[model samples]
Target: MTTAYLYVLHGRRGKIPESNLELLAGFIADEGQLGRIAFLEGDEQTLEDGIRDLQGRPGVDHLAIVPVLLYSATHIRWDIPERSAKVLDPSITVTVTEPLAGTAAVERYLERTLGAAVTAFPGRRVLLIAHGTPHFPEPFEELKELASRVGRTIGVEVVPTNHVGHPTIEETLADEHGPFIVERLFLTDGRLAAKMKARVQAIESGDVFLPTLEDDPVIINAIRERLAEAGV
Candidate 1:
């Protein structure tokens, strides 16, 4: 049997506050299946190196890197593959899985993260916030579509806004009537997420601020589903 190993590659933030990548790494390792997590941004060695280190214990033949990324950004398209190739082993079959977006997996995560807000206030609006880069806007667009899908599923008015693509998040926060719930929509709790959270705090009616995708247990299943979808 050719053993498989899963490396959950995470985007770089200043630190590992978002998913507690280190903790999840341990969790997946302890699960003792083909599950493992690697935060690309972490100071640890590359996925290939990790597999090489494991060579003595088990003769692994397959490796899959499940991107813990929320966007289809450059990191997904370029950085991960390039680095993986640099450290590739001729023996191990490597697979880079799809980035998470516009799927039932994401909707489930939204439900768990914001389930409390679904019925917390009778008429509060849901503001889904995401970030974008000047070079590309597709990431934000993709997230907007996912937000709409989630809103329809939950039967709520979801206003999709971007922190970088536009100032729409501020507009959504200012224009929305009465109390509103803010969901900082990203995996990492980095500078931008922090700024958005602070802005939400400034709003008197921004009563409920749900957790970001970082360090949440629900994320594990979501990643697993994506990996399964890719036949990992």
Candidate 2:
């Protein structure tokens, strides 16, 4: 049997979320298995085609559909599995794992990223920006706890801000002073990151750090570690 693992990415159409893809790729690469790894982009056609391909592969005994998302919202918990069943083989054993937000590795990544921001800002105020979801409380709360932990560790005051929901960027920015630095807490350079840059531009005295998806090796390593923990 081939024992291949199918890594499925869940998100909106046209947006692949390269950072998550890169992270997943890194983990698979580190495992030293090339042909055994497969990717499925999010979309109706792609999801169906990917599952069909997996089913046709004679060597694939187990299919682990890992959701490349941050939260366990409707998409990760329900939509992905529903779509998978459309093409999945009954003989094959398939398992769905939780999103990245459920891992402590993500919290560690956030700590390291925010710690660097705190060190750079020194006495200045710092804002950690996250892409929030109103329906999912874990992502926001995990990000907030990360900010608090990093603040306590570095002995600096750090404020956690969300772009879409509660503790919004506007609300957090309103209470902050000048010369602040806004560090993006997202895994990729997408709409959220772009909005954060625009929000920082409106602030007269603050600066923003635009780190690319490949900027931090710690995050890459963390993803690898998480995958190992998952026995992937």
Candidate 3:
């Protein structure tokens, strides 16, 4: 079945964030599979457009809406699916992949990031930050669990928190052992990531920021694997 890869990004005013565009282009490059990719920055391309385009293609039966987000939060359970459900037809099968960090793929990414940060800041702790919801506290718990698993894998201590969750970065940085390494569990350098990074840096000048998942070979490979799992 012919399938299209729909990239759902956290963009504003329908404009592709600078670094995100570069990362997306890179994701469609040599090593990454799913050559036919369509970027949807916020509402850049509505579900109607995607469904129409796919329906126009002969023999097309599947559409994979793969969110490049790092966590399985509200966006995964609500926003992305709600939007896609609007235009999906019974004739076509739709598969939306799980958020990035929850999958096994993230294990390697987290381990690699922790390993690198530890190498640079030998005695520092890891602060794994993600955008979490307040009322729906499950995601925060997921982040905490993920952090613990990653910390165990790499033999380090990880402190997980949502931007608006308890134990704010300031608290974590201040209360936790000094010289904390701020690791971003994000997909791109969007406003969310940038603002949070700036906030963390303002709090602690010496903190280190590990690379966001954006367009990394590992991330792209992980996405590619997810797309293939949609039975494309």
RMSD of each: 3.3, 3.4, 2.9
Between candidates 2 and 3, the TM-score winner: 3
- Give lDDT tens digits, candidate 3, residues 1-232: 6765666655556664565556566666654534343444455555456556765676767777777776666667777777667767778887888666777777787898788878777878888888766657777888888899999887788988667766667766676654578777777756788888887887676777777776666666667667666655
- Estimate, for each residue in 1-232, the C-alpha lDDT of model 1 and write its tens digit: 4555656565454454434666567657766666655556766655555555544247677776777767777777777777777766777787777776555666787865565677776677677887655557787677767777777777787777777666455666677654567788777677779888776667645467777777766566666777678786
| Order of models, best TM-score first | 3, 1, 2
lDDT of 2 by residue, 137-221 (tens): 7778877777787778767777887887787778777887656666676566766588787886776455757463343555545
- State, as a TM-score between 0 and 1, how close model 3 is to the true structure: 0.83
* Top model number, TM-score: 3
Location of the lowest summed lDDT over 10 successive residues in candidate 1? 10-19
What C-alpha lDDT does candidate 2 achieve relative to the native structure?
A: 0.64
Model 1 ranges off by over 4 Å: 11-18, 34-36, 46-48, 51-58, 112-115, 171-178, 188-192, 201-205
Quickly count the clashes in candidate 1.
Answer: 2
**Candidate 1 colliding pairs:** 18-214, 19-215
lDDT score at residue 27, model 3, on the 0-100 scale: 64
**TM-score for all models, in order of appearance:** 0.79, 0.78, 0.83
